[model samples]
Target: MIYVVEDDKSIRNLIEYALSEKSYQVKTFADGLDIVDVVRENAPELIILDIMLPGKDGIEILNEIREFSDIPIILLTARTDEFDKVMGLESGADDYITKPFSVLELLSRVKAILRRSAKKDTDHINYNNISLNTKKRTVKVDGKLIDLTYKEFEMLLFLMNNIGNVITREDFLLKIWGYDYEGETRTVDVHIASLRSKLLDAGKLIKTVRNLGYKFGEI
Candidate 1:
């Protein structure tokens, strides 16, 4: 299910119409407060949120939802200011669309976010002696808990989720980091190294793929 929070009725209708035409299940709420519970109850595949709304704004709602879920978020930015974009990214939004965005652009972003999330859930990929409790964003190895940053855990999960398949650094930047982060390839390598080192007993589960990048090996 796809949920949208937009105060503008016409714009909301347009988004609902466009995505629904493509056979996507869509629900819209005029205020963030109206549909906040829907997130917990329905678990949307993707969320389209407007930056300005009645009662609770997008940023507040984003923070609220993030307290409990990592559902992919696409912020409908109200301005072209770079700061707003940066703030939104820092707030855990998966993508952003500036005001007056074309329907084609919105559809493109929706497709990319959905595809990236789909790759993540392809299979139940767990580390040896380590498990990714999606509900908790945690990793445990040998019954000892390991601490990992949000992106660190995501990168580890992405590689492990793909198992033997080699995932390129570019894919990680685009999928896990967002396209706006500007070429953090080296960062991906660094995080993988750190996560592996911490895994200790289960470290062998992560493997370097020569020039390709990294992969998760089976136990």
Candidate 2:
């Protein structure tokens, strides 16, 4: 699902109509608060956030959402501040788009990211106590269900899909976080920890190499 939070009803309708033409499940909101609750309850795959929201700005929404979930966010803003864009990217936005943009260009970017992310999941993954249904965005451990945030699921799937290989922190920040963000490698480590903690006590399956990277080994 693509949740769009734009104040302008005309723009929102245009985007919704265009995306719907491609058969995508699209939801539109006039304000961040209008759909902020839905983000927690039923997280969409991607969010189109507007920076200059009425009550709560897009940056705040990104921060609030990042506190719990890591849904892929695409920031749409009128301000062309480099520092603000950097802040948005660092605050967990997967992509940033400036206002008065081309809908086709936006559509292409969204599709590309989602397609690449989807392709990354189905490549290779093997586990004894865990199972992931990539298409459904669901996970199972030891034949039981497990709950994971969007980022957690993506992080886990990325590791499992590349088991036995060492993935560097820089690579993770570039690919998963959507840029070579100016954050410490420890952020990746923290995400790995968060992903590992949810799996059924098999956190050690994700191996850490000192001064190197991470490797996922089947348990």
- Looking at candidate 1, the ten consecutive residues that score lowest on lDDT are 121-130
Whose lDDT is greatest here? 1
- Candidate 2 — which pairs collide? none
lDDT of each: 0.81, 0.80
Which residue pairs clash within candidate 1?
none
Give each model a TM-score: 0.58, 0.56
Q: How accurate is candidate 2 locally (lDDT)?
A: 0.80
Runs off by more than 4 Å, candidate 1: 123-219
lDDT of 2 by residue, 1-219 (tens): 899999989888988998899889998999987566677556676888989999999999988877655557889888988998999999989889897889898899889868765666463233645667777777765445688988788888888878889888887877688877987889988988888888857677898978988888843
lDDT of 1 by residue, 59-169 (tens): 888887776566789999778889988888899999999989899899999999999988875442344445566766777664467898888888887876787898988
Compared with the true structure, model 2 gives a TM-score of: 0.56
Clashes of 1: 0
